[model samples]
Target: MKALLLAGGLGTRLRPLTENLPKPMALVGNKPWLEHLIVHLKQQGIGDFVLAVKHYADVIKKRLGDGSSLGVRIEYAIEEDLLGTAGAIKNAEDLLSDRFLVVNSDIIHEISIIPLLEFHRNHNGLVTIGLTEVEDPSQYGVVELDMSGRILRFVEKPNKHEAPSRFINAGIYVMEKEALQWIPKHKEVSIERETFPLLIEKNIGVYGKTINGYWMDMGTKNRYRQLHWDLLDGKFTLPLKEKEQGKGIWLGRNTEIGPGVLLVPPVLIGDEVHIGERSVIGPYAVIGDHCELGRHVRCSETIMWDKCKVHDSTQLNNCIFGYGLEVGSRHILHEAVMNRAVGVIQG
Candidate 1:
């Protein structure tokens, strides 16, 4: 089945990280955020991908290529203008056949789509959305479903007092071809704001499937940091192979751990990462690909993205460093999320 990846958003909330790259291209683990979503969908038998691109469209296409490397056929729906979610999908209607999946590339989730699709097919629903319980439903589009899973209402970011239910839209959906008919072509429209409510009003079979899985919206620095911590803690499963006989360590391909380093378990070190001698890492740390960790550095619950360099005596705790950042020797960074470039400091 084809999947529509909504990758066109400006990602204003992600800030400096999004300033240079699109949110989908942000490093979440070792690869770009979009890569994980694509891989996950591919594993679920949804291979053909249509990425709706806007900001940095060329970059996304350059990085992902034809998706053949991941065993999927990839296509692009370049949005010349900023289109809303419904508009983006409507633009790609010609490419979509049968029941297809829709997802936001910015969110991180491990939703099992098979059951969701099954429910949609069995009920012959116009749309089936993936819903999950959240502590704060007010922050998301609150969904109310009947006993039979038919959506009673779609409340967009309701206040706590006005919330119909705790189940919120997971930004993942299985859409029947008929649902696209509601969306007008070349117009800015949101599925939540326009199409979903319209479907409910028309008594169309717009329903939801509640899923209990590891799900996170990495829209902020705090959420992004927590995602990496969860990954290191083995809270979620990936398709990649695990490291043998290592406690709390998920080493990706070609990673090198230096000697005399005190590594506490639950640390995820990605491919080609170099942890220098006498460095103390973890108790919830995530080191991304090609990182250069200098000697005698102490890090606790820190996340360093790809190609970052942390020099000697730099103590990092509860911090998240974006890709290509540099920390000089003898510097101590605590509880910080650094996204911009840093100049070298000579002691």
Candidate 2:
């Protein structure tokens, strides 16, 4: 099946990180999170891809040129302006097959599409949305389904007491090409807010398929942090695994650890990393490629991007550092996020 991935959100909430990256371009486990999604979809017998991109489309184009490297054929539908979810799919109308999959790029999941496809085909629905049960349906658009799996109604962010169901829209959809007719072109339109409701009002063949697997919306900073922590903690496995120096400790090539340096497990240190004597790292530390840590440094729950330098006696916890930071001596940071693109020593 050809899939149209909504890859164009501004990622406004991910401020510093999205300051330089599209939401899909955010790094998780030292690789683009979007790459993981592509690999997942490709594994499910869906090879042809259409990335409907708007924000930072150039960056995506440069990094994942033609998708040939991943053994999948990819095409990009670049939107000149920010198109809402449904509008984005409408924008890529010509690229979709008679039956297509539409997925939001900001989510990660462990669902298998085979069953969803079977349900969609059997029901002959205009759209079959994947549903996942959530504890707090109060924050999401909850779905109510009949015994036949036909969508009954949607409650947008209903209070817990008023909520009719725990299953919420999982941002994954299988749609017939004709469903595009329901959406208008050349303007912002929300699939959830407008089109889906219209189809329901018309009593169209709109269905919901419940998915029981790992699912997460990696749209916020905290969620991004959670993704890394979960992966390191063995919650769910990703397609790419880093080279391990020890159990739970992944070390890239040419990474050097000094004498008396203490490394806790579950740390990811990238290539060409140098750790000085007496430094303590890990228990969720991610040191990117070409990074250097000086003597007496202590870091935990930190993610430092490529070419970062932490000087002697520096301590960091729950911090995220973007490219090329040179932290000075004896500094301590907690819950800090730095987005410095230039290489500069900090004092």
Candidate 3:
């Protein structure tokens, strides 16, 4: 099966991080976020991929390159201007198979695609949207479905009082090639707002299948950090090249641990990491590759990207450090996020 990954968003919500890298390329568990999704899809037996790219498209191309290393055949669909979800898929119509899976690259979830495909095929629908129940329906595009599982209405970000259901569109879909015909060419269109509603009005088959599993949209900094915490806490397992040093603790090759250093469980330390004496790290911490940590430093619930250097006597809690950052001595950083360009430390 072929999959169309919508990865073109500018990631405005994840500012400093996205400023340097695309959302899909954002580091999660010391690997690109998109890599996890691709690996998941590949495990499910999907091979060919069409990546709809816009923001920092070249960087993604360079990083993923022909997808050979990933064991998938990848094709790029570059959009010159901002194209909404359906519009982006329409732009890549030429690369799409007769029936394909469309997934939003920003989301991390455990839902299986096999059942979704079966549901789509059984219903013979033009488009079948994956729906999941959320506590707050106001933040998502809620879907109202008939008893037969056919979509009756689409409400985009409804108010709490106005919401008709708790089930929201999960940003995953199975679509037949004919579904692309509904999307107009050379135009910005939203599948939720325009295409799906138009199909419903025209009496075309647009179905909704409720899926049960862990699902999160890693579009915000807090959620991004939480994803790491979840991984370490065993909410889900991600494939890592590093060896498991202990329960909930993974260490890469040549990682050094100094005398009197305390490594709490649920920590991931990357390659060539050096932890100084008497330093306490993690209950949930992700130390990226080539990081140098000084003595008496304390880090908890933090994510430090590659090549970061933390000076002695620094304390970081609930912090995120981007690539190549250098911290001054005696700094106590709590609930902070720092990146390269905007050096202004945020809490």
Candidate 1 segments whose C-alpha is farther than 4 A from its true place? 159-162, 241-245, 252-256, 340-347
Residue-level lDDT of model 2, residues 152-192, one tens digit each, is 88999999988989999999999999988989889899999
Q: Each prediction's Cα lDDT score? A: 0.83, 0.87, 0.90
Question: How big is the positional error of residue 169 in model 2, measured in Å on the Cα after superposition?
Answer: 1.0
Worst 10 residues of 3 by lDDT: 338-347
Predicted candidate 3, C-alpha RMSD? 1.3
- Tens digit of lDDT per residue, candidate 1, span 189-259? 98887889999999988989987688998898788878877776668765544363476667877877789
Q: Judged by TM-score, which candidate is best?
A: 3
Residues 1-347 of candidate 3 have per-residue lDDT tens digits of: 68999999989888777787788888888988898889899999999999999989998899898999999999999999988998999999999999999999999887788899999989867989999998889988888899989999988899988898999988999999998888998789998889999999998999999887778889899999888888888787788877898887899999999999999988999999999999999889999999999999999989998999999999999988888999999998888888866666776
Backbone clash pairs for candidate 1 read 248-266
Residue 315 Cα positional deviation in candidate 1, in Å, after optimal superposition: 1.1
Model 3 bad stretches (over 4 Å): none
